[model samples]
Target: MNRLFDKSIVLACCIAAALGLAVDARLVAAFCLGVVVASLAEIAQGERARRASEAASYAYIMVAVFAPSFAPFAPLALYDIARRVRREHVWGALGAGAIFVCALVAYAHAGALPARALLLTAILSVAATLLSLRTAQLEREQERMRRTRDELQERALVLEARNRDLADRQDYEVELATLAERARIAREIHDNVGHQLTRASLQAEALRVVHADEPGVAADFTDVKRTVDEALQLVRASVHALNDNATDLSVQLERIVEDARSDGGPQIELEVLAEHAPANIANCFAAILREALSNTMRHTRAQNVIVRCMEHPSFYQLVVSDDGTGAAKTNSRGIAEGMGLGSMRERVEALGGTFTAGPRAGAPGWRVFATVPKQQGDDAR
Candidate 1:
């Protein structure tokens, strides 16, 4: 658009110059011919054969010098040539200088204008060329700055994404370390303190047996034995609690799903939304899920399985479902007591949770659902 406006100004100047002199049909035709050829050359400046366009533009300027009325329009072609020249193109510089000198000579020989008019035209043409060169330089600088800005923005976005991933990795590492420490603590208690308590209980039992003939002594020893046994039970319970708490439900479920996938099992999707589930609740759900998946893989020709564990305000729920025709057949035949379904039911009922397993009512699949009241699960633990 800027180039077009500049060309328009040059054309207007040419018209003004022609008006100052006598206008004739020949001069008008020459002016029109020069304008059409210059416009075509400008339009083709970026084509593969742009050298041809440049040659044509230079040729038109040389021809215009003989038709003095069209001489003023020569600057349009010179401006394009000046803008296109690069520092590396030494031949291009020589060609442009030679064309300018030739045009000046042609004008001088024509003898159609006074020397003063000719000199003014020469000065204007030089000024126009220099302006074109400066404008082209500014455009190149602007394009370079734009590319640099885009590259920097792309790099900044990449760095920001990496920072977010790093932050998430750090958080996962911290959780894993905490789980490891808890497991270590549980092992220490079971190996050291729990063993010691068990030994004390055994020694008290032996003493009670040794003093069985003396009722009073036996009674005291028996009481001591009972106390030691109670202490041992407490220690075992604490160890079990620690071990349960050390388990991350989501991680365990993910490992199970990944293992199943690797073993050529059906596609399995597991989602655990119980972020802060209690140890006993988590343990119950994990055990049930393992058994449920085992049964599905063994008894059903399932193509897709979905396992979801969710925590509600008053209860925690787990659902394992699979899409398979075999499930409905199994349901119709009646699930045998020998199957793992009995064990799943026992685990859920022990925690005061409801358990149900059957073919879906309207869907073509099997669903095993269990829900334990939050209060009962915590109390059971």
Candidate 2:
């Protein structure tokens, strides 16, 4: 709307300039020449230049007042003056009003206009003043609204970031609580149940010493001692498994292989390419190793077993291979005959890991391989 008003004013100036060409051509030429010069000079560069341009515009208005047709352009100057002049300045306000009144008086006297024409001109001029004031007010309101919208958008972004930080903190706290509980359970089992198993094994040894003269009774005492010793080893292994820690992974794997070899199960070979791993990766590696070895011993009368562990920048891997009679194929996974293999697969894949177990191609043996991520921050889900 503001742009349209400016264009209308420019159009009025051109029409007035053309109409003045016939009535009193010499006076009309002087007025048109002044208006053109003032309009051209209005395109000022700086503060000093703008003040000079304003002075020239006022001079052109005084000269153009003689022609009744050039009356519409008078409001353009009044609008500019109203904006720059404060209301408290009485003299400035009166000066602008006097210039507008003089232009109306000169226009009314110069031409043989009717009384109705004079009244109409007065109404139009007053309406132009009100329109200029309204346009300025509208511009201020628009600027205020734009600033309000920008502030709202910035506040929303800040709130979203704060919410994300709160969620991350909550997850961290829950993970800490879970790890603490597991360690506490492992400690209780080692302190209470382990002590009873050790005492029982010692009692059986003393019984065999006391019955040294009787061969049959001594043999029974020897068997009881051996069984107690085996139970103690099993209990220790279980406690170690419960207390899952990253740095303890290599040590636990070694113990598992040693126990199997000493029990006349298989000639086992172990290789660890990387020892350092995150807690989740280390736990998964230990679980897969235990399950695979158990399956090889129970299902296949394997003569030899091989286990390998490797660590990469982002993940850890485990491979267990046994040279024995491979299990027969069924509907589910080849190793799904027992719950251990299925459980191990679920554990590995739960942490964005992969697990596979099957008979080795072109070989009379079975192999189990798995890879788990070093950082499974989201848990099983």
User: Model 1: runs farther than 4 Å from truth?
Assistant: 1-5, 8-16, 25-46, 87-89, 114-117, 211-234, 244-381
lDDT of each: 0.77, 0.67
lDDT per residue, candidate 1, 1-381, as tens digits?
A: 667777787677666555555668777776777677668756774556578767766776767655676666677777777777877875775676676667676667776755655665676677768877877888899899999999999999999999998996687678778888998999999999988988888888888889889999989988988888898889888888888778877766665666667467788988889867877777788788888787777777888999998989999999999987763557542563356778888999999999998888898877999999999988875
How well is each residue in 196-286 modelled by candidate 2, as lDDT tens digits? 9899989998999999999999999999989989998998878776775413556657767766775667889998886656556666787
RMSD to the true structure for each prediction, in A, is 8.2, 19.0
In Å, residue 207's CA in model 2 sits off its true spot by: 3.8
Backbone N/Cα/C clashes per model: 0, 0
lDDT (C-alpha) at residue 170 in model 2: 73
TM-score of each: 0.56, 0.49
